[model samples]
Target: MLPAVPDRAVDELGRTEGGPETLGLLVRDQHTRRLLLLRAVLDAAESAGPGVCPAAALARLREDWALLEEAERLEPSAHRRGRPYRDGPVSGRPDGSVPVSEGPRGSVPVSEGPRGSVPVSEGGAVPGNRPPPSPVRALLLHPLTGPWARDTLRALRSGTGPLTGRDTREPARALAHFGSLAAVAAARAGVSYAVRLTAHDGVLTLPSLGALRTGGPGSGETEVAVVHRRGRLTLRRPGEADVVVRLQSGAGAWSEAAAWTSAYTLPGLVLDSAAVPLDDLDPYRTARGGPRPDTLSGPAVLDEADRKHWLHTWSGTAAALGLGGERRLAEAVTLLRCLVPLAAPPGSVPGGAGGSCSGTRREAFGAVLSSAPATATVFAATLVHEIQHTKLAALSEMMTLHHAGPEARHFAPWRPDPRPYDNLLQGAYSHLALADFFQRSALAATLPTLRDAAWAEHARYQAQVGAVLPALVGSGDLTVRGRKFVDRMVEVYERLAEQPPPRGHAARATAYVQAARALWTRRHAPGE
Candidate 1:
């Protein structure tokens, strides 16, 4: 498990009097609120079993107002509405359920306040009327009640929020753990967490804490309540059964039976307990103004066989790469929170597709699994490659790399179109990680065939990097610091490049990548 934040530092809320602007940029914009919340919870959890007080949590938010504002400014305008909520037919309610009506868009206007401050009501209810609406309910009714509302409720309920502590390292790890749990939970359910914020009269409705009536895993369970008490999360009567499952700290475990039995039928694939089988959702094909091939729609069925297959591949790959430990897996899962399984498009190769969102959507990291069956090695390499992209995206938010401007486009070895300096950097960084993965796999493989394959992969990636590095090094678009960062990356790549692959295979791998590059340039490059 990752190290815990010290009580005093967490209590202090990790801020300094006046730090360099670049220091603030080091942390990704999307992660600001979450990082603060997790650190606060860790501090509170350590002090008392029940967690921190609501008032204290609110105060902590005030302290981190600056960071929160910066994050908000950087968030994409399209996603400012928080998670997407769907308006559809209702399923049967398990128990203790209330009727939920879909209201008009912008039914409730969100009141603005200073960055992280809870939006306050303009006026109180008349004395003759029923008592004033609960602040929490009113806040929930507002459209913008996303991270602010969630964090405040957690703090109010658990008495934990951000602290005044200056320690950043421990809190970062705790946030990573928190992210991992959320990702694992999403993967298990075959559905991303929908931020369903609704209000009937003065009552507030939050779907995340409420039971999902979908007939999938835990579908039979009439009501599933999420309880945060004593620094732990509990799912009461999860699945279509009468059993309670506790999500322990650091590592999370779920009921295998519940996971297998639950199934959600969606547009493209049926998400069951174990595996996500691809359907005609046509997720592999990208179209203009339409959802990306990786975009998920509707409910998914959870299949036991599929889920087990996925877990086996995931866990087995982790073990093969010596990353099978629970904490490491959790971190990887956290980094790869979204999993979209895609059906291969016409004339397309069957392979995994990876992507990471920019700006405030950094946490929205995900990959689309191919319809084809792949070995554990393929899955492992894909995971490492995609997660590395996510890591770089997050890092880019904090530091200036290439100079900002429209610069001449250069060929990215992997892509057909010319890319700007930044996109080139992204490809290079991800391929570098791929090369490293192959290098490590080469060392770890026991079978001669597998070992040879790993070497071939390493050489392929190395050559791809070599093809692009010269352009990156010579480009005037890079800042001095950015150039230095690239230099360090080159150093690592050069060291690995020296490790020759199996004799004949090395030359063949290099030739293949070079030939591909030449073909791409011929097809896409502008004529002199």
Candidate 2:
């Protein structure tokens, strides 16, 4: 409902610390054409089977890297370059779907045929120098190997993995160690999995697994078992990283979860070795920014006096807008708390920096509130507006869970009921944007500064999301319906500006939204 500012442009594209200004800017016009072509290979690898497409993609990437390296040698800093984060094997799963396990679905039995009578090397290598019967097995059993797990190993040595990076047995060695039982058990206990095993030196590259599960450190019970059809192996180490031995599944279809859920929600799912608890991240300590306070354990409770004061302030603004009523105020407050806490990651406390969710932690509402009417009105509008913005995040998570499988219950909010149009998540945002616009206009004279700041923030967020509307609507292009929705919101903002705040109940809020939307339709037809 807030008028969008025209100056803002949304940039969701990823950038590195010292990369080129843009991909296009990195190379000359003719060379830029070649870059786009090369990018296609990366995309294909990302989209297609990593086992199949990565080899080709990696070949192309390496070729390009060589050219760039050569160019830099001739003229240093000729093109923007950065220490690139290796396009590690894509999660071995397509984007948008829950990686139900560390590797692929399906189960493979442990090979019982023979341990190979060949003398196992003192370092687990065979002495005869005869190639092992199974190259994949050799890689898995070899100690000090790296991340070219069974899947990549098969692809390289046996034409079964993606062809992107080194195919030598070096990666195999890294895997043999981290993929061992000791590493797997440690990972399972929820420790950081992807530690720098070694720095990438020219001859030897250090490897890091995204996540691993191992046994209790120093405790015994160490062994490795391949699960999900040899697609993935469970590595258990008592106190180190837990390594998942995921193999190729030959399936290329990609899907995403409708919503994210707690780890417990899904049974037998593998946690990425890279993921650590949000609270555990960014520990409070004295540094360049000064001493940071430890985050509280949960949403802090407000004293009764503070609660009453807040209620009184919001109630007055609600009354002016004809949205006032004790029950409605209570409902709104209750909804605010439920929805606000939802913004925090599971187990997060106030002031914690990292979580599955991103964004700076906001101060508690009670801490910043006051008893003045203008203060109350501004607070009310902002609260309503924020509640609206949160819906999109909720919906995104819901969609993720829904896409994962039927078992994920986080998407219950989106189940199609008889009145299927009721999208609490979307509706909450839509209504709040409208309401905030109106409330801000009413208090313009008394709190001009707050009004402007709030409106600016609203507009910024709107612009941030505007382009994504078409994607959300699933039309791949903005449809008439979507345009009308935007138009109506704009109209309502104008209309609310013309009228005095109403003092009644549901009728006022309902009437205002209706008039605004109707005006929007009249001004712009669905297509127009």
Q: Estimate each model's TM-score.
A: 0.49, 0.22
Against the unseen true structure, what C-alpha lDDT does each candidate score? 0.40, 0.28
Off by over 4 Å in 1: 1-30, 33-302, 323-373, 404-408
Per-residue CA lDDT of candidate 1, range 213-317, in tens?
224333221333333322223344334343233332212323343321222121111111112212222111112132442322222333556555555565455
Candidate 1, residue 335: lDDT:
35
Worst 10 residues of 2 by lDDT: 9-18
Candidate 1 achieves a global lDDT of 0.40
Model 1: how far residue 134 lies from native, Å: 22
Question: Alpha-carbon error at 339 in model 2, in Å?
Answer: 8.0
